[model samples]
Target: MSKRKKAPSGNPANRGLSFVDRRIARDFERWLAASDTPLSDPHNAAGAVGHLFDITKRSGLDILEPSDTADIADMLLDIGPNATGMVDLFHDYVHFRLETSRDPRWHQAHDELEDVLDDDTGISAMLEAIITDAETRDPAVIADALAHTKVIDGVTKLLDWISTSRPITDTGALRLSDIEPAAAALGLRAAGARTLPATGDLHGQTAIADGITYVQSMWHLEPLAAWWRALLDTDVLELTASRVRPGRASQRWRTEPTPPLDVASEVVALVVSDTVLGDLPRPLRLGCFTLPGARHTCARGPHPRRRRQARTPHRDRRTIRPPCRTRLADARRSRPGRTDPQPPRHPIRRSRGLARRLCYRPARGPR
Candidate 1:
């Protein structure tokens, strides 16, 4: 008996393609055939989908087949969503898998879809939303979301590391040495620390290179930007920048001597009352009053929001503190029974007495 020829899965030979799908498939096949396709181009999900749609139309290939689509997704994942020419393509392909594939592997694609959709909105806001969602999402759902969005782990982890530090203080002197280990542990791709040319009035400060993944890692962008902004806002950093010549070849970080206790105390008081201080993240604001080993105590005390215990308004010339006991004791010893201290007496000026005598002396003619 002759053996029967086995049919190809999904009946690929019989699959029909639409005009647009065919066009997209033709372009994709052409792109795949090319030896050099720059991968750095930025495109959104819809654009990526449009490309894929054209590919399907041109090739008459059922690219949406679950197994084949899964393989496609894997290839895109390895290339990364930020790869030139790949971001939108990956996004579009994943969306297709989510909509058509029955494979459980693609179910979490919606989470990634949400993120890809959010890419155009701005990385800072996008990352903040993701972090907020992470706080509320089920552990399994978040894990799946993390798995689906390849860069989410690195992005969120970097944000986590940044958020954990006191923003302004820690960021003021941020170095690669401080961030590298954590970045490595979290799988973040941190660039080498370098000195940059002065930006405007600001001097060349310690700076971290923004790798290609910087944009792809949306959640980290805001915190990183905020950190740099905070560092720039530092008075000491600015002072150091003012002192250094921008074109210097030697890479040296300029540091200001720690403020003396009185200066630091005054600064703490000034910071606590400033409207801008209220706007800073609590962690950053909290560290502004740091001293060697002890935190500077604000005379006004903690949070500005809480109603300060209703202090009696001081009347002009009114005494707030009682008279010193030493003065009272001396006054008592002088007077023998006085409870209140008498005002100290002032000796009459000898110059004034001499002038009075000269004015009052009757015609003492011949002396």
Candidate 2:
């Protein structure tokens, strides 16, 4: 007699008792029917279902199967509610799984779905998930994940959206404090040790400084343009196109035009008296003395001529006189008794009370 084959347990083709039984299928169908929106609603649960259907079709599945439900839900969640059919199917599958198995793995699977769907939705949702996950799991692990999120992009998008949708108001301005975390997250630093001012206090000076700081930290050239505009509105700085250094292409930079020598001298005097003294670099001091038509020559040590000039006192006009010219006959007639000694041979003049001869006589012999 031929050995009789034992009746296959459950459906032989399905391989043992499957989770996707008639009951589960019926439950899923009822959920799908009861859904308020159709399975094709663009913004509703239908998108999710459609995505799942596509995944199932691609997987070569003829009918809804037990093992494929969780994975299909995961895939639908990955693409998010944008895929209506996939989301719808996933929602039904989730409800069916919850009723049938009540397994803890269902909770994990659902969380994964939620994460993919809610990412980039908004800061509130992302922040809530981050804070919650941080509290429940290892803080470092959750922090790592949070750091990986496109937080800066989200913030910039939110700010832009708010600015566009809402009317402009004092409160709409982004405050330094409000953006501190985002700036830190983006690894941007303020240029120096100064803290950025609040939005309300951002005037020309502060705005220029902030722009410079941003450029310095991020190396982005865009902010520099804004900085130029801000500087133009303020007298504290001036922008000029100049050959900043020789042999380099000329460009605009903030600088002060040199004042006249007299005015600069006053300023220097005031600064020297009011400010704490420090050794000025030789080049800087030399730069300050660059006056037009004036020459600067280094003296070899101390000069005796300069010292003599400094010591000499200026003479009065009355103390200087030209020699007086007189004829010998006139001198004899004016002072006949006084010039009796050969008529003193030459006319004389008194200068600074000292008698000086006005005319010269040729030397005679060796006398």
Candidate 3:
């Protein structure tokens, strides 16, 4: 096959075109100027708002940020309110504008207000129209839309105001009434306020205590242990508890590697014996109790006594016999050294004997 050729890499003949077609850019600049005037006109405000909304949406730029808001506001000013019909359109636009200002970014709000107020008509009429519209629109839809339009400047100003009051412990405690005007000025709705705790009320304390008790309950223990086991087995968590800090309790615990097989087996046995068996009533305990078997003659399909007999291990054991006479032979040979080489010792037998003697094993020699 023929080799493919690489394209030229240096600046091309169309470099300027690549940078944003100067003519189209200028056209957009002019349109922006024209939009300000049209936006002020009641008849033209909707279309301008729609266009600005679309532009900002498509740009993926946050219009709430100071830099973006300032840039957009400057562009709007350049377009000038005179170009659009009715100076009132500008007022409407300003009144419906959402607060996009964030903390410490007063520049955008200052610049935008300055630019708009500089116009002879001012923005009050637009505000009145917006307030009227808000009264008529669905509150839920308005709330959602207002949430999206939050201006950083409005939030910052409200926070600052709340800070001065000392009545609110935190900005989070401020009510809608406290910030509604700021929100309105930014063309947004104020959300409802939350109630504060009354003095001497211990609701938060009670909740914490209840949560701790719920966490400590035995029913939650196994699940919690399993969760911790899974975490450790996955190698994301270390077994050492020292790594955790008091204030960082909210941090997720990491997973560790799977535990040794013997440990897992022991855990399973403990869960079955200590947890399950210990939970049963004494008379119904496994291996110690006999349960009934099915009795076809009974209306309930089984007599309790028969069912108990079926479950009883002693009854089952009576029906089975040892595989060979090895045990008898071992018993005979075990009596005083008959010395016909004793039948090979079973590993299980050796294990049982070793286990019985384990308590007597000597301590290891000093290292």
Candidate 4:
């Protein structure tokens, strides 16, 4: 039998990227240079935005923090339609141009190069450049510059796409096909955005963008939990909450190890809600309630009455007896002079009686 040849590990730094990959990277670099966004340095802006996208996607929320929402809303309002075009164009280049290139391996090489450019070393120069620019720029210069630019509006739309339960289409935009995947991922019933009319008092382009914005915002703000609570104190999100695992859309359950039974009992699965989950510690934020069967897990803490009962301990004669003691007490009641112990029907109960004789037998004075 011949051993199969292993594929070589590809790296841009060691092996050097293909000419096509380098060209694509340079194109991306030029795009970043031409932009004037909130974060003057494109690397930092991309990093921050990418982090926000991931968190938003995982938690299924539009606004992670309420205080930041106003600032974000204002930023988006400032970044007009032109900025939105820039974003769409960039996504087109990344998703389509590289993938459709003549060289079969060009797509894989381009993806690898992009990943490297996102690293700390790749971004270090950009960070230093920001510092140099800051000497002449105003205090909190990035935030100030961003506040004035229309960049946020476009970026927010991109984020809206990322945060949605929908999967990104081949074109990097959400499609109707993505609805089911999105629903499964975020535990939301996905719906298509309402179609916009052809023309309006505003330019057709502006009107369409505004309509998209409105529809996306409307569905995102209204969580299933909030909708349910409005109708009743409790509501069912799904029938199989226990069987539902993390990364459902991605089929992560098939590979990821199921937590032990004891650990599973302690696990608290995260739900999609309006509340800020980003504020939680990482572990707890990801934990989902493993409610077996058709049970609906309560979000609220323990009941006040239960808390009081737990704190106060009392012994009840009928219920509190140990197996051995209960058997002895029964035997004493049943016959006047019978002191011999009766063997318990079950092996476990019999073992307990034998253990009782060993531990608590009347002490035969120094015997």
Clashes of each: 13, 21, 37, 12
Error of 2 at 24 (Å): 3.6
Off by over 4 Å in 1: 1-84, 116-367
lDDT of 4: 0.29
Question: What is the C-alpha local distance difference test score of each model?
Answer: 0.32, 0.30, 0.29, 0.29
Q: After superposition, how far is residue 260 of candidate 2 from its true place, in Å?
A: 48
| Candidate with maximal lDDT | 1
As a TM-score, model 3 comes out at: 0.16
lDDT of 3 by residue, 129-153 (tens): 5435644766455334433422212
lDDT of 4 by residue, 85-106 (tens): 3333333334443544465443
Residue 9, model 3: lDDT of 54
Summing lDDT over every window of 10 consecutive residues in candidate 4, give the lowest-scoring window: 344-353
Report residue 208 deviation for candidate 3 (angstroms).
67
After superposition, the stretches of candidate 4 with alpha carbons farther than 4 Å from their true spots are 1-177, 184-189, 194-252, 255-268, 272-298, 301-367
Per-prediction TM-score: 0.18, 0.22, 0.16, 0.18
Model 2 C-alpha lDDT per residue in residues 1-367, reported as the tens digit of each score: 9999997653232232235444444455556666664642433433343334434444333234333333344333323235455455566576556666656656555554454344334333433454345347653553344334342123223323323222211312123333333234334433322344444233222323434333211112212221211112211122223211111111111121222223222222222211111111211122322111011111111212111132114422122111111222343233211122221111111110000000011111111
How big is the RMSD of model 3?
A: 39.1
lDDT, candidate 2, at 202? 32
The superposed Cα distance between candidate 3 and the true structure at residue 50, in angstroms, equals 0.8
